[model samples]
Target: MKPQERSELIDALLDGAISEADFLRLEAELHVDEKARRDYYERLELTTLLEIQAEAEAADLEERIVPMPATGRRTAWFATAGIAAVILGAIALLSVVWAPDPAGGPLAAKIDSRLEPSATGFAVLTNQADAVWDSGGALTEGDLMPQGDLHLTSGVIQVEFFSGVTVILEGEADFTIHSPMEMSVRRGKLRARVPAPAKGFRIRTAEGELVDLGTEFGLDVTEQHSEVHVLDGEVEWSPKSEAMRRLAKGKAIRSGNGGGTVELSAQPGAFIDATGLEEKRAAVRASRRSAWLTHSRELRRDSRLLAYYPFDQPAHWNRTLTDESGSRLDGAIVAAQRSTDRFGFPAGALDFSPTGSRVRVNVPGEHRSLTFLCWVRIDSLDRWYNSLFLTDGHELGEPHWQIMDDGRLFFSVKKRDATKKQKDKQVFYSPAFWTPALSGRWLQIATTLDLDARKVTHYLNGKILSEEAIEDEYLVEIVRIGPASIGNWSDPSRDDPHFAVRNFNGSMDEFAIFGTALSATEIAELYENGKP
Candidate 1:
């Protein structure tokens, strides 16, 4: 605790409002927070100890009130002296006990010098290929089960469980394992290796849940969707809205971004450079997540010029990215990019229900005309889903939302005629496997579809990403639609899913989605003041 908090605890204890257990907790923090530690020592030495002595002496004034019998009176003097000797001996013993610091011991000293109970024993962030860690962070002994968090800033972190099972952490990772059967992926991505004699573990993400069955493989999870790549063992990717599919090594399934399951080989890198979507997953430092947020924000805000806002308000962000040097950031932000030249925030907040980002104001279901307009600054439009992302797709005939795995924004939709899209579409945009990468820099994205006309179109920064219709039965089914979700391109779980966390890294500002297709002038106006 901080010094102020610690002082309050002490005051509360002295006043009898707190119990002994409460005091012990505060005492533990005093050992951690330096200021609290020092203040406690000073108060004990200069004030409390002296004050208690005075009280004890005052209590001694009533000693004469005791009347002793003949034998008792004779014994009283000796008893008093004996008790005083006992007290002195006890004090001496305690002094000796407290004098031997752990730094002087053999094993105790060695361990103390090597290990520290920080977030993780080791880390490898995305920005650096080099690995870093504290000695205490690794499990030197048997199966080192972390009773706490092992931060994976960006990319992935792999752990070998005592049972010969392994677990891999995807970027922006934070999780707690309750046991082999239960765990929560507070954010980012994770892949667990389940050994025999175990039913595997239960993993939960911000999107949904997973129950593994002795699976040896990788799981890539972001705030947008979850991609499962089975390397060796068998596992099942289950979704609450859809049926569960059992997966074998080399096979993969996507159960996110509002659609149903799509099967693929779980192939190693294809979109590596763009989303770092490597075919084979690799290990990354736990601190890389922090670095990505830092850099991504800096790059984006420079593109926007901050006079206007992009994405949402400047909140709705909380996670972390720490550098090898231990510098940390809780939200996506640009440092010292505070020049007047910049016009928008890297990421912002909204003040509506659901309070989402990359916000679109619309009704859910089906609609005839739709438009999504948002402010954006781009590093590379060639990278997938730069500014805003939204999609309406389905698997095996159910409607869902689709999102880019990197947590950037992308655009997609269902073809109402359904059969046409299932046939004439590019494999990447087809019902079959193959995800697209939206490219360009600083382009505003505005996407829309006229359901009655069976058409689709996109506008980037202020240009077009694509405009076409694949035609599908599912597309025809969407009549009215939902509001444009801010901060995100799509929430697949909402309608369907990939991603690191619920928060995005790039800056997004002044977003809106309407029922009608907007012209290039209108799209550009979104970046200006009051352009509906």
Candidate 2:
């Protein structure tokens, strides 16, 4: 790699990027290149200076007396590097999935350059609208991160924007991450979410910037005074008054007294994925456009578990679409879907059914984490576990996440070992779907998981629907998906997918997933996109 390339490579490495293999390759190259080594040492010195500046700044920031925003959800942090537990499912049945609309929403980007498979996150993104997503652990110059329900394990995160800027996240941090366009560190310690713009990209922060093209990642800053986090990407991180750290993911950098910086630890290099690079970039754009102070409200309608997709766009038309009618609310005051027959009311709900044969995301690939959000209206009761999604792992752990026969939402995450499967059930409310105008109206459902957090959360129309946890650790190979029809369960002569009718009465919309967990801010963002 040329000197310029070496510098770029160093920035990515500092941001927690570059696999062990790649790190070794770079290290060997440096041994023979004295100039490269010299240049690296010089940069390292500058970063050290920046860290010194940050400590002083943090002390000064203490005088401000800032009020922090509520994290909303509590994360059950888990940090054991046990078996990866990531099973690679062959792309056999899911190979030829229906084409997703080429015009899917603008994707959010993850500026964190270092997202490893085991580095748990519970958030994701899709275009301008989505449930939640992780940063995908990539810190591309223009990468985007998914918004909504975000939670991180005990680790640091450095996010950058398209215009050469960055923001760093500290441990156990949780917040609704919007793009670098407009951001606020409601919770956790963020270096900065603002960056200087380069080319066509424009960054928004305390005071947005227009940076130059030649920029590196990880210009992080977190305000303890207010528990706010900021990421300055691309542009050279020369703080105006010296404040917090502006280094990469693992290392620590500060902003103050000429902007000092330093390496906090020397953990082993973790592997990274370059495949989902595009999706990560899109997250940046989406986050850039998100509003900073949006509040999310739960949307719960009591009716039937009818399939509902938020938009009437083309891609959504690809998911399994099923419906029901003359249905009554199984639990709530009314029903999730009222009967008068409003076919296209929600515009793009899954009245038809996204699948017919097997269940699971029609897309190929064995993803480590996933988020499933749905809008449902139900009216009938049937035998067995009525499921929204199932995989080869059924009643067994990793096989099913469903509304059980007992009118409760249950998920069997890890069925292999009794210990793996939560000994206690995370029995949550199975509020029958809600309908329009009716007491039991239609509502939205959002669910997510973060491997590191060792926890899961369920939401109903912005509000947390399930107050409990699903004992099973949801470890599955195949992904099954469907709107429990009149009768269908894997168990023959016993449990079957049940409902009032095949075509659900209510509308479903804005159902998607992310690599990480969704946050309240993100949920509110989704509501805005899918709101009437």
Candidate 3:
């Protein structure tokens, strides 16, 4: 096809006006033509960029576009020629937008790195929490790291240096990165593994520099003292203005700023392996589930059961869940796709994307106390409120269990009391817990409301994360909080202005609702059996 004809076809395709025959013809031509494919992609990229720019500058464009005087002589031809010239100019501008100059300053920079390659495979961000990072934000695997200081205020981080050296830093650790081969742990616990090629790795603490002589070691530093524990192989501990001491495997040395050193046997188990961090976490979860399965049958006999949804529906999504509870409050999966990878269960889980997906359950009546339990694998905590379970709209005495954007688990109840002559709805929220990195991992969570005791409790991995006592005004019982749901909540009132925000983007399984508040032991049992 001619260049002008090809451009017309591309424009029609972009405008969604291309006929089926023309689309097939264009597809066939582009399939075998390298230049045509290149042209198409370039045009598509340029068009998308121009559209975004146009949206941003729409007001300015409207102000600038003044009506032109009527011209009769070849007006259509002139307009067509002008549009052709604009298209050519846009194609030319594509290269600059697609690939900018390397040394064009930070404004034109795509990645923030100091190296010539812009990224040195210095270390992999295995796991992190509350650690100060650069503008690039939460470092993941394969993210390049330039030489800089890593400050950990009150959370742990695991990093695997490219040289096969893995290091785990405890809280309050001040670590300076000199290169991939060298780093200084000024404070807190630094457990590292230096393999054959990375033997010269050194850690400079307050007292002295400990050089790894092909070893695995844990070094701790405090205000007045420092300790080095050699787990495997050996390390050379050199004190400031003092003689070097060769510490062998199974040995530990503690030295104070003022005096003599104390030597003892090293505990290898005390150190965590950064490379196997995720694996260890998975193993612990597996162990918990294994322990719970032993008594799952006995625990299922709890008399306070209101509803139990195993989410074992196959093929079809919009179906009633197997309600083990005799109350027959069957739940349903709505607008959720069944995950292909079952994550080890025979029945696959329902994945709820942030597109207003949910599982609904309309409990018939109210209860004095309530409990919600489920296993969730969170994809992100990006939204202000990501619902795990919610009962209807933001009405009084409705339970809303959700996770805040900061990875904190929250449980709230909207209470409106008539006895106290309170006209406004008062919300009671549970104490927040700093959740660890929860992406792509299954977690067992349970929340309980005891109206008699006027307390709310939250559990994770079978242990209590937070507990809050319900205030007197907020101790109202849950009364017919209909339109119960999981993964997302919707407002019932058409006049309500607030948009439904917390659409969960993750997988959920084994959702259970109890009529009475579960004790700590019962909560642990639920976690043990239901963990994936």
Ten residues in a row with the worst lDDT in model 2? 73-82
Q: Which candidate is the best by TM-score?
A: 3
Determine which window of 10 residues in candidate 1 has minimal summed lDDT. Answer: 321-330
Clashes of each: 100, 176, 1
Ranking by TM-score: 3, 2, 1
Query: Global lDDT for candidate 2?
Result: 0.38
**How close to the true structure is residue 39 of candidate 1, measured as C-alpha lDDT?**
72
| Off by more than 4 A, model 1 | 1-366, 378-410, 414-442, 470-477, 489-503, 524-532
Task: State the lDDT of candidate 1 residue by residue for 1-532, as single tens digits.
Answer: 6567778786776556877887889866764467776776676576565563444344355645333334644655445555676788789888887677856766565445334442432221222222123222422112234566655455434555444445555556667666546667756555455777656566776555666777555666666776777766677777757776788778987766676667779654421221242222222322333343454354343322211223323333432211111111112232212111122123332221121333333334444556655544332222233324333223222122322333233434433333533541211121211112121123345565556666665554455555666355435444344433334444444322232113233444344445466666756544332211
Better by TM-score, candidate 3 or 1: 3
Task: Give the total clashing residue pairs for model 3.
Answer: 1
Off by over 4 Å in 2: 1-347, 352-368, 381-384, 392-399, 404-407, 417-440, 467-507
lDDT of 1 at 33: 61
TM-score of every prediction relative to native: 0.27, 0.29, 0.49
In angstroms, give how far residue 495 of model 3 lies from its true place.
Answer: 6.4
Candidate 3 residue lDDT tens string, 366-444: 8888888888877776677888888777677777888876566777776653344564343444454423333666778
